[model samples]
Target: MAESEHSSSENASMDSIEEHSKQDSELEFSDDEETLIIRMFNLVGERWSLIAGRIPGRTAEEIEKYWNTRYSTSQ
Candidate 1:
């Protein structure tokens, strides 16, 4: 019973960490970055790596997720 309780606590801690990371990943982009991302996305299309490279301090995956979540027509 003690071990089970410990395991549950660990799982809860892990879930909180995961939730924080998800929130961090959904970072706010500056106006310039937003404009650049939109323009590059339009010109190059979902080419996230290329777009991320053009923007400082952002990853391809993050940009892709942000665009998909906030701007993608399919969403």
Candidate 2:
């Protein structure tokens, strides 16, 4: 009886952990994608030249070319 109770508790904990892990993974993925889209928009939207300046080693021209390529392929 004691062993059964312990086993049940362990199972419950494991199930909870698994559920939380799944939720964490989903939230992380969504946040990452949202961040990427926001960055791409901010880079290409108004004040683009300033943002391009903010990121060293990256030029507005190259960024524009990258976006154009992405736009062409995504369609």
Candidate 3:
């Protein structure tokens, strides 16, 4: 039905928006940034907002996620 098709289209648009929002929140790290995060993590012990402030251009939530994904287990 046309209504069903319209609803599906709306769902697809919403999905695309969600995906874009997730991508926007993801921050890319340079080698220096990675080193800084590791060092700060050692110094502060998962105090991500402080570490993020030291790194520049990254949110605390993003830094926490990145550290958890990439480095948490190693330390």
Ranking by lDDT: 1, 3, 2
Identify the leading candidate in terms of TM-score.
Answer: 1
RMSD to native for every prediction? Answer: 3.0, 11.1, 3.6
* Location of the lowest summed lDDT over 10 successive residues in candidate 3: 66-75
| lDDT digits (tens) for residues 1-75 of candidate 1 | 999999999999999999998877566788898999999988999899999999878999889888877897873
lDDT of each: 0.89, 0.59, 0.85
Worst 10 residues of 2 by lDDT: 25-34
lDDT preference between candidates 1 and 2, better one: 1
Candidate 1 — number of clashing residue pairs?
Answer: 0
Candidates 2 and 3 compared by lDDT, better number: 3
RMSD of 2: 11.1
Tell me which of candidates 2 and 3 scores higher on TM-score. Answer: 3
Candidate 2 displacement at residue 67 in angstroms: 23
